[model samples]
Target: MTSAQISPRTTAEPTSLTTRSLAPDLARGAMLLLIALANIPWYLWGAEQRDLSQHPVDGSTLDRAVQTVMLIAVDARSYPMFAALFGYGIWQLYSRQAAAGTPHREARALLRRRHWWMVAFGGVHALLLWAGDIVGAYGLVGLVLVALFIDRADRTLRTWAIVLTSVLLAAGVLALISAALLAAAGADLGASGQVGVDTGVAEPSYLASVLDRVVTWAVGAPAQAFLTGTIPTAVLVGILAARHRLLEEPERHLPLLRRTAVVGIAVGWLGGAVTAAQHLDLWGIPAALDWGFLFLQTSTGLLGGLGYVALFGLLAARLRRRERGPGRVAWALQAVGKRSLTSYLAQSVLMAPLLAAWGFGLGAELSSATAALVAVGVWLLTVGLACWLESAGRRGPAERALRRLAYRR
Candidate 1:
C-alpha cells in the first residue's frame, strides 16, 4: 500500500497512560537501576587494572563483594533486558498501527522515522555526555529488524532467534576450547585485553573527553547492535514473545513464565558466577581463559534478561490480584519507567559532571561500594523527577521531543 492510502487520521496515537501494561513498564523501571549499576563502574577511572567485567582487580573486602554481586547479577544482563523490551515496543508500535488501519508500508515508515530520530538522539547523547550510550545501538537494531522481519511469519522469527542463539553459544564454546589449548601451550593469557578503558572518564580535559566519547561511541554503537549476538538474539525473542502477548497478558501464560524465570535465571547466574570467580581469583583460572569466561557471561546474559522479563510479568500478575493498587514505591517506579528516556539521559547528566575527571573527578576517589551508592542516588533523583512529572500530567522532555518529531502532523 502506498503512503497516500493511509490518512493521517488513521495513524495510531501513542498508547495512553491508562491503556499501558504494567509488566513492561515495571520491568523497565527496575531495569534502569541495573543499568545504573552496570554503568557506574566505568567511572572508577583510577583503577590500575580492570577485569573483563570492567571492575577493578583490587579492592577492599566490601568492594570486592559488591563487585562480585554486580558481576553475577548486573553486568551483561541489563542491556539484553532493555533490548528485549525495545523489540517488544517496536512490535507494539507496528501492531497498533495495523489496528488503526495503517498500511504496512506506512506503519513501517513511521517506525523508521522514530528509529532514525533515536539514532540522532543517541549520537548527540554520546557526543555530549556518555560514551557507553545504548540508544543508537537499539535504534539501529530496530531499523534493521523492522525492515527485515516485522512482517515475517511467527515460525520464521522463531527460527532466526534459534539460529542466532546457537551461533553465539558455539562461539562461546570455541573460545573456551581455544583458551584451554592456549593455556596448555604456555601462552600468556594475562595479555588478553581488558573489557573497558579509561578513555573518556579519565581524560581531564573536557574537549578531549568529548572527542574520546564520540569516537568510542561511533565505533561501539554499530558493533554492539549487530556484532554482539546477545542483543539481536534477545530482540528476536522479544519479538516472538510480543507475538504471543506474553507480557501484556501474563496470566494466560503463567506456566511458561514460571519455567522461563526459573531456568533462565539459574543458567544466567551460573555463567556469571563462574566468570566472577575467575575475576576474583577464586577459581585460579589462567588469564588466557578470560575471553572464554567473557563469552560465557555474555551468552548466558540473554537468558538472564529474559528471566528478568518473566519475573516482572509474574510481579504484574500478582499486583493485578491485589485489592488495592500498587503502593507508592511501585507507583514511583512506574512513573520513571513511563519517562525512561529522560531518566536514562538524566543519569548521564547527573553522573558525568559529578564523577568524570573533566568534572568533579570523584570517580578517582570512589570505591566500588561507594560508586554503587552514587548510582542508586542518581536513579532515585530521577525517580523523584519522574514522579513530579507524573503528578503534573506531563511527559519527560526527551519523550515529548521524540514524540513531537516522530508523530508530526
Candidate 2:
C-alpha cells in the first residue's frame, strides 16, 4: 500500500492566493454561516433534548418554518461543502509536498504531521468551548482515507464513486417500493410512536456537562462523520473534482460542470420532495418515515451536494474570467478559507460565552428566529475580523501553526 505523501510545491508563490478560487472560498464561508444559523436552535436545546423521533422545533409556527427550511435546504448541504473542501485541501497539500521533491517517507511524515495538527486543534476546540467538532472527525477519517487512497488514487476514487452511487440508488429504490406497498394498504405517515428521554440524573453543572459531551464526541466523531452523514459522499465527490482539476483549473471542465449542475438541481429537488412526503406521520416508526429519512438523506446528499459544487465551480470559473481583482467580500472569504481552522475554532470559542447555561442560560431559551438572527451577526463579525487579519498578517494563526507543524522544525 502506498502511504499518503504530501504534495511539494515552490514556496515562492508563498500564499497561492488568487482571485480564481474566490468563489469556493465565498461559498464555503457562506456554508459555515448557514451551518451556524441552523445550529443555534439546536444549541439552545440541551443534547438530551435532541431526540430525532420527537419534534425538536414543534412549538411556534416560526419554529416549524425554520425546521422545514433547514431540513429541506440547509441540513444536508453545509457539512458536505465543508467535507469536500477538506478533501480539496488534502489534495493541495499532497501536490505541494510532491513538487518540493520531499522524499516519499518524509512527505508521508508531513501528511501525518498535518493530521495531528488538526487533531490537536480539534481537541482544544471541543474542550474549551464548542461541542460540534468537525476537525476531530476530519482528522480521523482523513487518516484512513489517505492511507487507503494514496497509492492508487484513481482506483480508490473510482471505487468510492461506484460504491456510493450504488448505495444511494439502492436506498432510493427501496424507499419507493416501500411507499407503494404502504399506499396499497392505505397507510398514514402522521401517526406517532412511543419515544422518551432517559437522562440518568447526573445533573452536573451546565458547563461540565457540555464539556463532557464535547469530549466524547471529539474522540469519536471521525468515524461517524465518515460512516453516518454526507462526509463519505463529499469525500468521494471531492476526489473526483480534484482529479478533474475542477477547483484549480475548472475552465477545462466547465461544460461538464454546467450540465451536471442542471441535472443535479432537478433530481435533488424532486427526490427530496418525494422523500419529505414520506414523513407525513403516515405509517409510524420503522415504517414510511424512518425508511424515507434514510433515502432522503442519500438522494439529497447526491443531488444537492453535487449541484452546489458544480454551481460554485462554474461561478469560480466565471470570476476567473472577469478579472483577477479581489472583491471585498471575496477577499474576506478567502481570508477565512486561508485560515479556516482559526475561523472555525473562533466560532466555537465565541459560542461558549453565548450558549453556556452558566452564562446567559440562553442555552435552552431562545426561539429559533432569535438564534438565527444572532448567528448572522456573529458570521458578519467573523468575516470582518478575518479580512482585517489578512490585511496585516500572512496567514490566519491556525493556518500558520499547522503549516509550521507539517514542515516541522
Candidate 3:
C-alpha cells in the first residue's frame, strides 16, 4: 500500500501506548474498583432481601453512613464513567477498523460476534453468580454503535457527536412528555411493567430470570437501545475527544475540559435531582412502587454519565499538571485498566464464593459498611494482581483472548 494510504489515526495523540493518558487508565481502574465496591452492598442486600427496591441498603448507622457516601460519590458517577469509557473504546476500535479499509459488513460481523460472546458471558454471570449484569447491555448497545459508524467513512467523528447529542436531547424531551402524561393520568409506574414485588431470594431462580431477561432483550432491547442512545453518543464524544487529543495532551484541552466540567455539573445536578425524585425508596425496592423509575434511570444515567465524563476529564487535567511520578499505585491501576475484563470477571466469580448462599453465605450477614470495606480489600488485591501480571506480560489473559478473537488471529 502507498504511504499516503496509511490508515487515519484512531487513538488520541500519537496513536501509541506511550502517548495515551494515564487518566483513562487510572479512571478505568478506579471505575472497576468502584464496580466491585458497589456490588458488595448490593450483593449483601440481595441476600438479606431478594428484591432490589431501594439502592441504599439498610443496616447499622455505620453501614448507613457508608451507603450514603457511596450514594453521593460512587453511585452518582462510576457507571457513567464506565459507559463513557466503553464509548471511547468503541471509537478507538471502530476508527482503527475503518482506517484499515475493512468492509462495513466485516466490521459489523466482528461487533456482532463480540456482542454474542458478551451475552453468553452475561448469561453465565446471571445464572451462576448474580443477576445485575451490565456486560450484556453494554454489548447489545455496542453492536448498534458498530453499525452506525461502519459506513460513515466520509463523515468526521465530530459530526457523529452532534448527531448523538441531538438524539439524546430529543429522547429526553420525549421521555419527559411521556412521564408527564402518565402522571397526569394517575397511572401507576414502576421500573418495568406492573409486576410482582421484589422479595430478593423468593424472587425466582437465576436461570429462570436470565431466560426471561434474554427473551425480554430479544423483544424490548431494540426499544431500550433506541431510548438510551448512549452507545452512539459515546462513540461520537470519544472520537471528538480523540481527534482533538484531549485525553492525551491535557495542557491543550484543559480550558475546554474545565468548561465542560462546569456545564456538566450544573446540568447534571438538575437532571439527577429530577430523576432521583422518581424513586420512592432511595434505599429500598425502588423499581417496584415508584412512578417514573425507568424515566429516572434513563435521565439520571445520561446526566450522571455526562457529569462523570467532565469530572474524570477535569481530574485527569489536574493529575497531568502535577507531573506525578510513576509509582507502584499508578502502575497497578494502569495495569488493571489495560486488562479490565479479567478483573471484572474475577470480581464476579470471586464474589460468588464470598457472598453467595451456596458458598460462605455472608451476603445478608455482612452490613453495608463491612461490604464496602471488603470491596476495598478486593480492589487492592486485584490491583496487586494486575500489576504482577503486567510486569510479567503485555496483556491479561482475557485481553489477549478478546484480541485474538476480535482480529481472528
Candidate 4:
C-alpha cells in the first residue's frame, strides 16, 4: 500500500520534538519525576536486615510516610504510563514516516534500525549506571510490536489488549494467592530479601557490576518487562488510542476520559494504599502481607497508567482553553518532556554518583525522605536544563543523536 493510504493526513510531524503535543510531553516530564522518586531511594535500603529492593523496615515515621507515598503514587505506577506513551510514540514515528511519503517497507526498516540502537543505548545505560534499566526492555518490546501488531486493525488491537490484560491479572492473582497460602503455611518464600545485592544496584565491584547488569538486562528485558503482559497490553491500548488521537483531542472524548480517569485512579489508589498499609502494618507489625503484593502491582500498572494518561489529557484540554495555565512551570515541564529520553538518562547520571556505592555512596547514609528530596532536586535540575535547551531551540543531546540515527539525516 502507498504511504498516503496508511496514515491520517495530520500536518504536525510526530518526530518534531520541538512542537509535539503538550499533553504527552507534559505527562512524560511528570512521569520522569515519579520514576526518579520511586527508583532513586530504592538503592538506599540498608543491607543489614532490609532487602535491597524494598524500603528499610526500620525507617522513622517520616521516612515511613515517604515510603508509603511512593508506594501509593509512584512505584509500579510509572512504568505502565511510560510503556503506553512509548507505544504512542512508536505509532507517531511510524505514522510520521508514512505521512512523509516513505514507503511501508522503508518506514518499517527505519523503525527497526532505530530500535536496535535504542537497545544499545539501554545496554550502555545498564552497564554504566543502574541495573534496573528499562530502556532495553522498552526497545525489545517495541521491536516485537513492530513485527507483530503495528499494522493491525483497531478491533485486533482491542482484542489483544483485553486478552493480555485478562491473562496478566489472572497470573498476578494466582501468584498472590499461592504466596499467601505459602506464608500462612509458614513458608518464607515470599519474604522480602536482598535482591540487587549481586547486581550493581547494590555495592559491587566494577567487574561484578558489569556482569550483574548483563545478567539483569538479559533476564529482565525478555522475561519480566514484556512477558508479564503489562507493557504489551498498555502498548496495544496506546496504539488504538492513537488511531483516534484520544490524548491529542481530549475534548472530543470527554465522557470517556472522565470515566476512565475516575475509575482508574480510584482503583489504582485503593490497591496501592492497601498494599502500602499492609506492608507497613500501621496497626502493628505482623507477618508478611503477600495478598497485597500482586494487586498493588497489577492495579497500578493497568489502572494507574490509564488514569495518568486520561487525567493529563483532561488537564491539557482545560489548560489549552485557559491559554497556558500555570504558565512558567507548565512550559518548563513540557520542555523536559520534549527531551524525555535525555531527561530519563540524566536522572541516573545525576543520582548514581550521589546514591550508588560505586560512586560517592550517599545512599548508605541518607534517609528515605532525604533521598526522595534529592531525586526531586535532580529532576528539577534537568527541567531547568531542558528549558534552557528549549530557549536555545536545541534538542537534548540524546534526542538529537537518536533522531539523526533514526532518520539518517
Q: Report the Cα RMSD per candidate.
A: 1.8, 4.6, 5.9, 3.9
- Model 4 CA deviation exceeding 4 Å by range: 1-14, 45-53, 181-192, 282-292, 324-326
Instruction: Give the candidate order by descending TM-score.
Output: 1, 4, 2, 3
TM value for model 2: 0.82
lDDT of 3 by residue, 106-213 (tens): 555666666667766665555555555666667777776666654454256667666666666566657656656665676655445322322122233544545544
lDDT of 4: 0.76
Q: After superposition, how far is residue 175 of candidate 4 from its true place, in Å?
A: 3.4
Query: What are the TM-scores, per candidate, against the unseen true structure?
Result: 0.96, 0.82, 0.74, 0.90
lDDT of 3 at 60: 70
Residue 90, candidate 1: how far off, in angstroms?
A: 0.7
Task: Give candidate 2 regions above 4 Å deviation.
Answer: 1-20, 46-55, 153-156, 172-207, 218-220, 271-288, 323-326
Highest TM-score among the candidates is held by which one?
A: 1
The global C-alpha lDDT for each of the candidates, from Candidate 1 onward, is 0.87, 0.63, 0.59, 0.76
How many steric clashes does model 4 contain? Answer: 0
Candidate 1 residues lying further than 4 Å off, grouped into runs, are 1-9, 189-199
Top of the candidates by lDDT: 1
lDDT of 1 by residue, 18-136 (tens): 67888888899999999999999889888755446778888999999999899889899999999999888888888999998887888888888899999999999999999999999
User: Which residue pairs in model 4 clash with each other?
Assistant: none
